[model samples]
Target chain A: MKFLCGIALIALPAFTFYCWLLLDSETFLSLLQESIPIQTQYIGLSNRLLALVPGLIPIALLMRGAWHLRRLFGLFAVRAFFHEEIAQRLHGFAFMLVFSVLAKPVAGALSSAALTMNYPEGERSISVTIESGDLTTLFIGVIFLIIAWVLREAHQLSKENAEIV
Target chain B: MSILVNLDAMLAKRKKRSRELAEYVGITEQNISLLRTGRVRGIRFSTLDKICEFLECQPGDLLEYKSNVDLTQ
Candidate 1:
């Protein structure tokens, strides 16, 4: 449990930094051009920075998820298995993941629009993309949410059992 | 609340302390205290068996059902 907490502590910042770096990289622009129906050549530095604005939505959600995961691990490390906070943190992380997945298409559309904002007025486009990865994330998030609910039920049972002689 | 615990009376009749019964029953003194005061939700069958065996009494001697008792209280 301590090891997992340590890993989560490291992963939180690592993932956040990785996402920021990825969003700012040239590779991301090329990938965006391939996935989004937009002219990557017309995307200047200002447009690229503008495009990063939409990416922040998922990044923020993921960061919050990571924070909740770290806290949950911290509770486990202290042997607080049946604590209400454990279920709450798991629920928070799960919902953050679910919201991040849901925000993907909206962010993608906004990013595409931001990227094409500098283009000729008639040439600008707004495109929404949904990949298989988003569906997978949503599925996992729902599973975690169910687990959190079960954990809460288990906590209640534990409390009741503790009151018994 | 209708199911009343008479553990205190049984323990007194048996001339045994709560600490001694707690040790023999493999439970905490705090739990014994709760049982004696009728503050517990319920007693496990194994624990009840241990207590009855230690006190040489039946389950009925340690518990009673009172229909007129105010459950909420």
Candidate 2:
């Protein structure tokens, strides 16, 4: 379990850096076009950098979620299954997931606007999208929130049981 | 907080060490110590039963209800 978490912790930032900086512009634009349904002309370096500004919101949220998940896994690796902090970290991760989902459309619109900002005035566009995948993520986040609540209840029960004999 | 553990007194009357009671009760000596000091929240019925059987005492002899005692103090 810890091994998997370690791999994920290492992979997350590497993957993010690759996607954000290392990937070629044409490939990145093609991927963006697939997700955002926006027409792209020749995207300048300035516009790509500008798009990263709005993109930072969801990225930050996801990174925060990963941080909490790592902590939760650390506790689990030590067999602290009912530790109070387990529920707290899980709650934090779940909260981040929900907020990240909520922030996605806003970030997408701003990023779209940023990407197209170099276009002629009438052609510049901001597109807000809510896909089925976003809904699925929202649902999973809500389910995780409920699981966190349940874990808190279980932790309380464990605490009370520990007080006995 | 109102319920006081009289385990130490019971152990003295029974001529049994906390270690002996802990062994008979299948619990740790630390838990036995906790029970003796009245520092525990509660005791399980099975543990209480084992202690009672080992010490030849009733539950009432091992526990006392003291009214108007401030636990926080």
Candidate 3:
């Protein structure tokens, strides 16, 4: 599982960045068009890229947090899960998950606004989706945060108990 | 942290080295050092009994309480 997470920690961002490049670069726009069909025409490259910034930032942060989580799990595989470092990493993962879940709607709005910014006055399509998955992700993030808190308390008690020998 | 250990004074009065006491108690010298410095949170009853037996003294002879409040008041 740790090894798989390590692979994902590296691969997810690489794929997201590749998608970003395909979307942002004119040179790769043809590839993007060929791979994914979209009716909306992109306008004002700078503004579009700028708008995409909000979305990309969260994705990057999410990837970074997952990477940290993977490392923490790796430590756990070596029986280091009872340490404060594990608790810290769990907290970090929980926070990043929360941020990612909350930022999704904002990213969706930014993308929709960016794509339709310069479209014909009456023909622009702005789409906002509220997915059930988003709610599930938010709930999972909250659960992870609660688990982190419990782990923190457990680690503290373990430390105190170890000292009592 | 509030429990003061007088293991060192007892050892000195018994003319016993910490290492010797630790060997007799079947514990490590490092733990003996911890006890002498009052750094350990608590000692096991078996270990304390062993130490007391080895030192020829009661537990009270090797342990003291330093209260934060003034009990006299």
TM-score of each: 0.81, 0.86, 0.77
lDDT of 1 by residue, A85-112 (tens): 9999999999999999999789889988
**Residue-wise lDDT of candidate 1 within B1-73, one digit each (tens)?**
6888888888889899989999999999999988888888888999999999999999999888887646555
> DockQ, per-model, please?
0.82, 0.80, 0.55
lDDT score, candidate 1, position B43: 88
| Clash tally, candidates in order | 0, 0, 0
Give, for candidate 3 chain B, the lowest lDDT window spanning 10 residues.
B64-73
Candidate 2's residue-wise lDDT over A31-114, tens digit each?
Answer: 787556687656777887788778778777877888889889889888987789998999998999999999989999998998
TM-score of chain A of 3: 0.76
Estimate the overall C-alpha local distance difference test score of candidate 2.
0.84
Ranking by DockQ: 1, 2, 3
DockQ-derived CAPRI band for the predicted complex in model 3: medium
Which portions of model 1 miss their true places by more than 4 Å? A1-28, A34-37, B67-73
**Between prediction 1 and prediction 2, which has the larger lDDT?**
2
Cα lDDT tens digits for candidate 3, A45-86: 665565567657668768877877887888889997566888
Worst 10 residues of 2 chain A by lDDT: A1-10
| Highest TM-score model number | 2
List candidate 3 stretches off by more than 4 Å: A1-3, A20-48, A77-79, A121-126, B23-26, B66-73
